[model samples]
Target: MKPLERLGEAKTPDGTVLQLYRHDGAYLIRADGVELMSTRRHLSEDKLAEVACAPLVTKPKARVLIGGLGLGFTLREALRHLGPDAEVVVAELVAEVIQWNANPEYALSAEAMADPRVRIVHEDVSKVLRNNVGGFHAIMLDTDNGPEGMIMKENSRLYATRGIAATMAALKPEGTIAYWSVGDDPGFVRALENAGLEVKAMKVRAHATSGPFHTLYIAS
Candidate 1:
């Protein structure tokens, strides 16, 4: 069957969505109710989750920061791994995205907004990190497309030397920072080292499929 198409969406006290669209069998997230993500790839949710928390050996009793909620995949993974003492702070710049998760009428985020462990802040994550009062045990940024970014151009700052320094300061000693990338970025690895964090950079497929690859940075 063809999926749902051109349904209208919007931002209330929640987050943003002009609309959504159905292409083939997949519904996409659209600015004017158009589609930007898909259900066909929902199979990858568990994979993204695995990568989000792969750095932790035992369950972590600490704090976590998840940059963006792209389809809520990584957040789901992070919550699954953290121990009961853990808390997740999500700083999403697009207020609409936060609203998207709460719009029960359309079900944009599929209940991610309701997770007890998650605290959604409708502000820019960079500012939150720089001004943050406390530190985290694991900081995972599924934000940006790696060195490349998907949303705002200003996001490039998050991968810079100064940005890495801010991130490092937000972490506890031996804390882990995990970043998801659309591709590999040697420059980011260098920046992480400059920040004085031991780093691991590796490539992993988006899902079990060998095709459609992506990269990850695990630093501490």
Candidate 2:
């Protein structure tokens, strides 16, 4: 068994304590002693920023918004697929989690922070989506374990009907919104449908280098 090491800490808007840890070369975030993400060599544990882009972000001027910054895995993987003209904006609620990437001691796994095309915003993703930045090419959300939402009480709203609508409004007509889940979620898909999005879920296996086995909700 791989040992657990404390990496950092994060607190939600409502003041829930989240502890970051590492195991077997993977990173995990926990809240009230519950394991949030047990990272592997793959990005599915932090999907949206990495795996979700496989189908949608092909253009040279793709503007992407990544929700969550877990270990920087998804952000780094995202950079690999984007062109020089691409721009990635990450929305992270916790400032410390962002620091983990910039902090010299933590060894930023994704290094997305250092990238010239990346922008980190310290705020709730839900509020930013309300900003309706307009004309975003893709929006990938890996904010919680899944639609079930345990890390933060308000996180479930992201999967709610209104939230889905807001996300759709924030995107261009041809834009894609990809959601990451720890497991399968059907209700969230229904919300996407209610928002008038053409939705497709791609099931991806949780692992390293295994391709497209995880379910990605591609709503356009």
Candidate 3:
């Protein structure tokens, strides 16, 4: 096997180390020694957009907000599922990640980024949710590992009761929010319910019908 080569690096707003690596034709983004995302395994990430935007297919002028742009799988799938009138807003905390996508060396989501329906925002997603009231038909969050995990400590608020309320307020009537987690989070489920969302939890494989399973929470 070939060794992983470090291609670039950046620092999160909170000073966390974000490194980009390439191995065997695949790209990886890691933070503090933990893999944040990999080009080789993103089935669940694509599923996040598929399940969330499934209902929006018929909804005209559908607008969606994607909290994280890891590898752009979610955004790419979202574009595939929605119509020409639809719009996708991707909020990414790290600017370097966006740059990585645009860099031909990585060849990750550059075309997706150029799609007319897509908009890029280099800011925290929570702020976007708080500021845009009833603006989105669907919201997909794959920012960190899960509700309890933290790539950035501030992201925790997005899963808390208050944050969930903000997210709910940001959605249009019957609009859905999907959260991608490494595993099930019962407490987070309860929090979503307490915030008055109708919730459904699904167990999805890391790859299509194989690999470890991850959890995707869909709430309306």
Q: Rank the models by lDDT, top first.
A: 3, 2, 1
* CA lDDT, every model vs. true structure: 0.66, 0.75, 0.90
lDDT of 2 at 126: 85
Q: Candidate 3, which ten residues in sequence have the lowest lDDT sum?
A: 148-157
How many backbone overlaps does candidate 1 show? 19
Best by lDDT: 3
RMSD of each: 4.0, 2.8, 1.0
Which residue pairs overlap in candidate 3's backbone?
A: none
Q: Indicate the residue-level lDDT of 211 in model 3.
A: 81
lDDT of 3 by residue, 29-122 (tens): 8988899888888899989999999878888999999998988899999999999999999999889989998776667998999899999999
Residue 27 accuracy (lDDT) in model 3: 86
Sort by TM-score, best first: 3, 2, 1
lDDT of 2 by residue, 1-220 (tens): 6778887777787888888886665566787788665555345645566555665456777788888876677788788878888888888888888877777666565455878989899988888888856757788888867687557786888888777878887786577888887666787777778768888877767675664355677778
- Using all chains and alpha carbons, the TM-scores for the candidates as numbered come to 0.79, 0.87, 0.97
Output the lDDT of residue 208, model 1. 64
lDDT of 1 by residue, 142-194 (tens): 66455664444556788887778788788777777788777777777777787
